[model samples]
Target: MQETILNIYLVIDKGSVTSFRAKAYEMEGEDSAKIGFLKERATEDFASAFVFDSPKNKKGEYMPYKKFSKLEKQGLQYQLFEEIFEKFRVPQNPLICVTPVVDGEVFGKK
Candidate 1:
């Protein structure tokens, strides 16, 4: 069976410098349930945005945020989760980003 890669990204709005495309955070090979949880968190935090995608498709198609957001209002929620930190750090700003070429070096290493 093919592994599911749940890709999480940060979408800068039209006014921001990085508004052209979504900035990738990390790819997650999690089950649908965990993916759902990640989506839920993103929806609540980023509002109606499809920053999370399945790169397996490779189409780079934008997922309908409204559809997910509408269904979630019916009480979809997660209680607890495990924390795994691999690429989270304060480089130039407090915001957590993983853009290597645009955001500069990872962990500020030369």
Candidate 2:
């Protein structure tokens, strides 16, 4: 069995509740060199928020909420993510999902 390697990048914006632009490339081989390359590219390309850490699964996406809630409950981190909920409600920065070049098809058709 063989494993398919994927390259993903994210752009995090700073100011309020950090926003991001995520991109993923599904490629052939897992080149160790490319991992470092991706890290460098992502850092340079995304200007605002710096890379805190690598990406994780979706289910864990909302886990930050739980963690922040605990912190707020325990009086830890001064500001919680929920504190900026109202700001995220604006239209100019509506959430977006972009799936580029899926399975060698740019628009989903081969």
lDDT against true structure, model 1: 0.28
Per-model lDDT = 0.28, 0.31
Models 1 onward score TM values of 0.23, 0.27
Model 2 shows how many backbone clashes? Answer: 0
Highest lDDT among the candidates is held by which one?
Answer: 2
Instruction: Tell me the deviation in Å of residue 20 in model 1.
Output: 12
Off by over 4 Å in 1: 1-7, 15-30, 47-86, 89-110
lDDT string for model 1 (67-106, tens) is 3345447533110000112223212212222221123212
Per-residue lDDT of candidate 2, residues 49-93 (tens digit): 222332234754422334434764886532222222233332232
**Position 32, candidate 2: lDDT:** 59
Task: Give the 10-residue window scoring lowest on summed lDDT in candidate 2.
Answer: 94-103
The per-prediction tally of clashing pairs is 0, 0
Clashing pairs in 2: none
Best by the TM-score measure = 2
